[model samples]
Target: MMRLSVATLSGLPGDIDRPRYDRAGIGTGVVHLGIGAFHRAHQAVFFEHALNAGDLRWGVTGASLRSPAVHEALAPQDGLYSVVTRDGAAERVQVVGAVRDVLVAPRDPAALVARLAARDTHIVTLTVTEKGYASSAADSAAGYLAAALAERRSTGVDPFTAISCDNLSDNGGRLKQAVLAAARQSDPALADWIEHQVAFPSSMVDRIVPATDEDDIARLAGRIGVEDRAMVKTEPFRQWVIEDRFSGPRPDLAAAGVQLTADVAPWEEAKLRLLNGSHSAIAYLGGLAGIDFVHEVIALPAARAFVAALMDETAATLTPPPGLDVPAYRAALLARFANPALQHRTRQIAMDGSQKLPQRLLAPIIARLDRGLAAPALTLAVAAWMAWTGGRNDLGAAHAVEDPLASVVADALGKATAPEDRVAALLSLSQIFPVRLAGDQSFRQALIDDLALLQEQGARAAFARFTGR
Candidate 1:
């Protein structure tokens, strides 16, 4: 019956796991973009642990770029929320007080710029997904970041680290490129200063944080005896591998189970290719099969073997990170994907197929082609995406496909329904497929065969054909 807030922290039940430090005493040192479920479950929880260990300066000021929804949800609660980590029947509930305030960018862009320029704000992190990095400086997160950094420069304040927790290869470099490119449009001088001064550190973050629904909120409220509309339910496993590069002081994140390294490429590539690649395969193929959840897909014998083969093909293309056991790491990932309590939906991952395929699936396919090897599993995954993108599932049910390139996909489908024609039409999309892959006869033939098989045999049978099981 009670609402969660800093004032109510002390009045909660004695058994409730609430903030150890005084919420009012903590200062905001990090400004995080995209106040979504993933950030709440992963990064904010880590900051809560650091705060619990007596670090008061690492509190986060959450910012949302598009709407006022997150700001509206958390402001009344003083940025208080519950994070429940679920692994099968076991669960741990904790109230996180790491976020002190929430800022909606459109409502007050100047406030966000001021927060970024603040002297105490040493880290500006983002989980805005890949599409947030717009190519132009006119309307993007990079544009806003550029404007804020320009303000800091004009005021003679130092630059902070720009950490990207997005799942992209060489994401730090990409962030730097986006930021510098945007800054160049306004002031070449400011761009130069940011390039020379600020640190754009790439990071690899892994956590299965599902989109919370009314059921999740009600379940948390029932357990904690307080209403927490901003609750996040996630899997127990978490990993954060960050490049050890920063312009200003940062919290000892290593104490919170973060891996600080000189090079984050291997880790980033591994997670992208191994975890993300197979995830896409499961999403597209499983959705085509009318499977609702990732755990259900991974539980299938054919699906499990298909994912393993996909990972094996991708692994051949990667150089493992130092001290990492590739085999053991992969086995652990399979176990994590099979966690039914996480309830990671296939439809959730199936969205944004056009934007995601380039990095997650296509890159590994390109690598295999370069090595003069046939990546049938990867090709089948690509075919599955093409079929799914046609705007209907195997059950003939029409679901909303939420890709930025929805028009492009529709155009591709309109051109032809024949296997070869459809495969050619989709492959010619230079945005998603590389020029070399598009031109390769063998790759094109392989994709056409797989696509035809998917159409004729259905998703499960096509998957069994690829796995030869």
Candidate 2:
């Protein structure tokens, strides 16, 4: 058992027997906002592999706005961590050394502003999740962008690019609005500068990086023969699509399986609607049925059929983006969701239901309804969400609901005359559902009916009825 610095452990995987590349030479070029399991397993791993294969100047500097755990764990070891990739056959272990530093969000607003103003910091990326943005535009309010813009206006330092790795539609544009709005509040001149200098690039990031469990840590230690404070496990598949908007020198990530293009809207829409939407369906429905793991739900016959049907409906409405094959892409997504080794828990995916429902479920429902197609399955999923949010599941386990309006939601559910009214009240929150969707009578009733069914028949029977199988 050797005690190695995080930096040293990062270089160990490649240096086990034969050296891959000059691990010590990699430099940090990107700053990531959320240092969560997904980023560690997906983006960090990509950068690590690229660095080992002779690419440099693309190391990641992980940061967080609230969590001190990431900073505390990685800072002691020099911003390095281990990633374990698991599938059915074999587990590939790697140490990622590409993270050069980790920063906590500025406790002092001025200092946080100054950090972003740094000239050498080329790309500012975020995995702060959907809710982290505090977005309000059919999404969160983009609070981070507002803060950054306010800081930039006062400081006169320019950021190169604002990359959003969250699962949102037009994430870059959404973030830009928040930043520009914040800038406009203080100084119009700063808003102009941001409009001209800052590049808010949209991206589609995918990976099923589950939270680290004890067995995962033990396996990492056993395989690598070292102590890794920060270890993340994920499924084998990973994809990153970015709009090529950079204010400074950027990495040639295109050489490492990343797609760079002028427009990432179509790709973003496809991923959000297909993969993420399917995930939301499984998470809410499965969690309500007392299923704990995502793979376990997908393994069930009825749940798998429901998911496949949803994907089929989604695929019908969406054409694949350029350079993508729809059928193959979907087949792969289904396979990824079914990976038993990953054991992605339903509750983990179920978090942030209020923020996630719009993008992952409601948006697709709107799209389908616009085309005059039935989105009954999606509606049922929404019903399950309302049930789950009411703070009780089939097992009587209290759901650790995390929405900002949790108390309001709980109180509303308590006083509502029936399931339909509960659905209506939740939708009317405006903070969760948009005014347009909230006003749709047909949509509201569909949700009510499905929720009533869920309460009466239970999740399994309700799902069986919806699928008619």
Candidate 3:
């Protein structure tokens, strides 16, 4: 079977959409990091729209910080890949040509730095997940930006706009700090210049791109009559919200259905609290109840209602962006979660609880407290997470808590056998909890009560009480 490339595109089904622009005339103006499935399905597709709109300078070159698999697969096919948008009943297949090249940073760090330093590369985007920014090694995203920005500074070149498309509060601000720290490790003067020149824009990217396995590969091959190694599967619904800040010229992404806003803070808060907070609820509670996938969790009446109630609790804390219908957004999130075709694993979202919970749950909990309200559902979600870290399900099957702080969590858990003691021990971890909140009697008691209910009655009973089932 012919691999998906510029050459095999001519033989695709007439209904299938291929790039309308000439690939040969396109230049790489955007350098992307963490070229995972999310980047391919979301930002790369948006850039394809920019290219199709006749702006040939926005073609992308994706660089992987560590993984060579993406580079190996895409580079062999002229950096071409396919994105299939599933809407439950049917699929929309399209070949994305926005990515003109691929690079592996570890293979040749100089190559990636050179690409970032290129004159026409006015933009740099990333989908390296939340934990990617926390890595301090020189091979990480922050390290690469520090290196490239230093080179650009030395050579009298303008710095590129660095956009973080990860889900976190003040995502841009966090990335800027990380890059600055990395730069200061070697050159403080260079870090100072980068602080004033570069623009680290926060962006909220919404799309469900599941990890494509061989089954997906074969299914897409049957549809497109080609064997593409880098095919990404996503839902028809896609959204990108970017902060309106840039060091140089950027593509007309607003025309590509992107929301370029002056303040991404409100939008980020809404997503983190509502959508992501509910997701964590489903993952911990559902994963503990012996559920495997997200749709399966939503299919359970108790689980579904619990998730909705959790979102409702968090929604009370957000001041959403204008024109965003809160009720409708919550409904859409539930609908998206219930899509069975996507095969989104609950365990996948359950990873990095220590890293994720502060943004997703704790923020809203604090907000609700300030409003003189209780976060019953959100507090229970945290309890479910504590139970999940015990590494076994209600069915007595082994469950893995895939977190960087797993051993620390275990040590905390091991410090006590009683529910209240366990709650107190975990709360004392300065990494996940703030000093004020961790020491508060009301908050600690709430966690103790919730944890007692879950550990004693199991997942169903606790969920039943939350849902009034």
Best by lDDT: 3
Q: Against the true structure, whose TM-score is highest?
A: 1
User: Poorest 10 consecutive residues of model 3 by lDDT?
Assistant: 460-469
lDDT of predicted model 2: 0.75
**Residues 196-309, candidate 3, lDDT per residue (tens digit)?**
989999988788777788999999999889999999988889988999999999889889999999999988888888888898899898888888888899998888888888
lDDT of each: 0.88, 0.75, 0.89
- The runs of at least 3 residues in candidate 3 whose Cα sits more than 4 Å from the true structure, single-residue gaps closed, are none
- Any runs in candidate 2 off by more than 4 Å, and if so which? 1-24, 106-114, 135-158, 466-469
Report the CA-based lDDT of candidate 1 relative to the real structure: 0.88
lDDT string for model 2 (1-52, tens) is 5534633544465533322556467666677777777888887776776777
**Model 3: how far residue 435 lies from native, Å:** 1.6
lDDT by residue (tens digit), candidate 1, 387-456: 9887788888888888998898788668688999999888878878889899999999998999998888
44 Cα displacement, candidate 1 (Å): 1.4
Backbone clashes for every candidate come to 0, 5, 0
